[model samples]
Target: MIRKMELKDREAFVAMANEFYHSDAVLHSIPESNIEKTFDELMAGSPYIDGYIFECDGEKAGYSLLSITYSNEAGGLVVWVEEIYILPKFQGRGIGKEYMDFVEEAYKDKAARIRLEVEEENERAIKIYEKKGYRQLDYLQMYKGK
Candidate 1:
């Protein structure tokens, strides 16, 4: 099931975030020293950011973090999927598709667009995205390097 993360989920969230971030397939890993502090500062139950926890039979199975933004171009709210991770054992159970379906329905009326980025090398993820009808956009994502 899909539900907004609650305070009680903090420890679980942190652990999952850490595990997902450090996986060899994950190209974007936060500094080892700042994980907790960074999560606290930016994701401490902020309204602008929605962290969704996925559960199966009451067990924490995965999570997806989404951020809302005001896009003048869209002239409305836009949603971005910051990160999505399903635990190792739970992989290939259609959980990711279910999560995307939940996200699509949740934002159907409120968001002008929903966006996510995937690494070129993550072929499994790419297939899921393509099957879900997501198309590659022309614009590239850029960030100011440290």
Candidate 2:
């Protein structure tokens, strides 16, 4: 089951987020401070971001972070799936697919697109995403952050 993250989920969320950023799934590791800030923003009820905790048999298994933005190209709101990480032991149990379904169902009426970034070398995740009907965009993504 997946549920909106709560204050009580801070510890598990931090642990899992740390593991995720350090794992091969991401290009680089982020400081724990960043994770803490994200948690603070979420708990503060930030409208720009949302976080969810994934549960398996009543146990905390993983978490996802999403951001929302308006996109002229998409002609509406876009839901950016910032991160999704499931513990190694819990993989292949359909949680990833469940997350996709959850996003689709939750935003079908409100969003014009659901987007995410995946490392090219992460074939496991690529396969899952491909099967979910996600396609790659030809435009290069450039970013400038403070």
Candidate 3:
């Protein structure tokens, strides 16, 4: 089952977030405090971010976080999916695809597009995204550290 994230699911979500990014050294360890803050922010109605949690067999299994942006160029709401993960133990069982399909159907009338980024080397994720109809963007993603 996929549902909007709630305050009670913070710990599980944080655990998944930390575990999903474990191999990447750049992401900070998500502290309990940070998770609490995130939960509060989401409940407080932040226009910028929203998250969804996936439950399997009555347990929290994974989640996706999205940030919304409006572009005059695009002329509608664009949803940038910053994070999507299903625990390693729970992977390969169609949960990810189910969650994505749910998101697409749920937001079909609201969002213009759902966008996500995967590292060039992450072939597994790339394949899944491509299978879901996401293609490579023509523009390069340039960023600077603060």
Candidate 4:
């Protein structure tokens, strides 16, 4: 089942997000401090973000975070899929699609476009996003050092 996230899911969400961010694959876990602050901000109810948690038989299994932003170029709201993940054991079982469908339903009236980024080398994720109708962007995503 997929449902809106609640405060109680914080710890699990953080663990999962850290796992996703800190490693290229599912293993080689990193120390908590590496992602603690960002996780805390999400838990604090960051205004532009909403989280959806996936549950299996009443236990938290995975999560996705969506961030909505207004795009002057699109002339409407755009949804930036900040993060979407399924535990390795739960992947390839249609849960990720369901979670995405849920997001589509949830934002049906609010956005003109939905966007997400995948590592160029991550073929599985690229295929999944393509199957979901996302296309290559005209520009690259660049960042400045902190």
What is the C-alpha lDDT profile of model 3 across 9-59, one tens digit per residue?
A: 877887877776665522445566666676678878899889899888887
- The C-alpha stretches of model 1 lying farther than 4 A from their native spots are 32-34, 37-44
* Colliding pairs, model 2: none
| Deviating ranges (above 4 Å) for candidate 2 | none
Ten contiguous residues with the weakest lDDT in model 3: 23-32
Could you say which candidate leads in lDDT? 2
Clashing pairs in 3: none
What is the per-residue lDDT of model 1 for residues 14-133, given as tens digits with 9 covering 90 to 100? 888888898855786776455566456455666678888899867999888888998988889999988898998888998999998899999999999888988888899889889989
lDDT of each: 0.83, 0.95, 0.78, 0.78
Task: Using TM-score, rank the candidates from best to worst.
Answer: 2, 1, 3, 4
lDDT per residue as tens, model 2, 14-48:
99999998999987899999999999999999988
- TM-score per prediction, in order, is 0.88, 0.97, 0.86, 0.84
Task: Give the RMSD in angstroms, all C-alphas superposed, for model 2.
Answer: 0.9
> What are the runs in model 3 whose C-alpha is more than 4 Å off?
24-36
Candidate 4 residue 93 C-alpha distance from true site, Å = 0.8
Worst 10 residues of 4 by lDDT: 25-34
| Residue pairs with backbone atoms closer than 3 Å in model 4 (clashes) | none
Q: Where is model 2 poorest over a 10-residue stretch in terms of lDDT?
A: 137-146
Each prediction's RMSD to truth: 2.0, 0.9, 2.3, 2.8
lDDT of 4 at 20: 80
Q: With candidate 3 superimposed using the best TM-score fit, by how many Å does residue 95's alpha carbon deviate from the native?
A: 1.2
